[model samples]
Target: MRIVIVDDDPLVRMGLKAILQSEEGWTVVAEAGDGSAAVAEVRRASPDVVLMDVRMPGMDGLEATRLIVDSGSPAKVLVLTTFEVDEYVFEAMRSGAAGFVLKRVPPPELIEAVRVVATGESLLFPASTRAVIERFSEAGGYELPDLTEREQDVLRELARGHSNQEIAGHLYVSVETVKSHVASILTKLGVRDRTQAVIVAYESGFVRPGDAAEL
Candidate 1:
């Protein structure tokens, strides 16, 4: 996967580039010092993934993510943040970031996160992510879409961070059936992926952080 590392700190960008380069089939196509430069680099590189730092001098990662998504770039943004409950990280999610990873994450897990987001899968950090959403997300402002009872159940399972296989086993249904429910849920919620779906569930009072055990 081609990736652009965007961070104001030169050392952080260099470190991330080194870590990503050590992985097979991953390339550091470009690097940017700040959010505005990151946007330009993304346009130039056309990378599959962007490792975005949430805070920057000029545009910031959140605005950069918004511009990239609005411009119809296919690159998936994976935000890098120091704080798990950062308000900017939540805004980044709203701007269409695929997911976020902490800067202090172990190299293996960080590499895996990049791969997962690059493959068009949402990376939900169970404990910290859920806590952040629950803390910041206001309840009962927006109306939820019409979902069947089974779909609601599936959504609840999803909010609990269950994979399709796990949701299937829990619901006593086939994995294919669970996948169907997930797709339907995503469509009805008007969200990109499972992470956004779970965010909606929490924001809509459909699920609470304490309701599920952390993975």
Candidate 2:
């Protein structure tokens, strides 16, 4: 996969580049010191994935992600941030970031994150997602989408990180039925994948952090 690293800190960019380069089939196509440079490099180089830092000088990663997606670029952005619980991460996800990996993540995890994101699989794990949800849930309640009874059950299971087979087992429904419900949930939430659907469930108040019902 062709990848670009964007960050104001040279050390961080270099560290990430080195880790990514060590992996087979991954190449560091370009590096940018700031958001504009990152955007320009992405346009010129057309890397498959962009490892973008959230804060930068000329433009923030959020705005850069917005521009990149708005411009119809094929490059999927994976936002990098220091604060794991920051609400802006949620905003970045909503703004079209394919995934997020904490800046301090281990080298192996970083490589994995990039690969998963590049393959278009949204990465929302239980531990990080709970922190993100609680951060927003503290501010105010998020609005839940209008969902049928079955859809609500599916959302609850999804929020708990249950796959289709698991949710089907838990809900005593057919796997096909669970799949249909998940698809309906995604469509009703207006999100691209399961990760984004879970984000909407928490951020929109469809589900609250530590809501035992979800567990």
The stretch of ten residues in a row with the least summed lDDT in candidate 2 is: 120-129
The model with the greatest TM-score is 1
| lDDT, candidate 1, 1-215, per-residue tens | 89999999999989999999999888999999888898899999999999999888888899999998888898988999999888888878767887789999999989988987876544456566666666777777667899999999998887676677778888899988988888999999988777788888878877765765644
In order of appearance, the predictions have TM-scores of 0.91, 0.79
Local accuracy of candidate 2 as per-residue lDDT tens digits, 83-113 = 8888888788778887688888889888888
> Mind sharing the TM-score for model 2?
0.79
The lDDT per prediction is 0.84, 0.79
Model 2 spans > 4 angstroms off: 120-122, 137-150, 162-183, 212-214
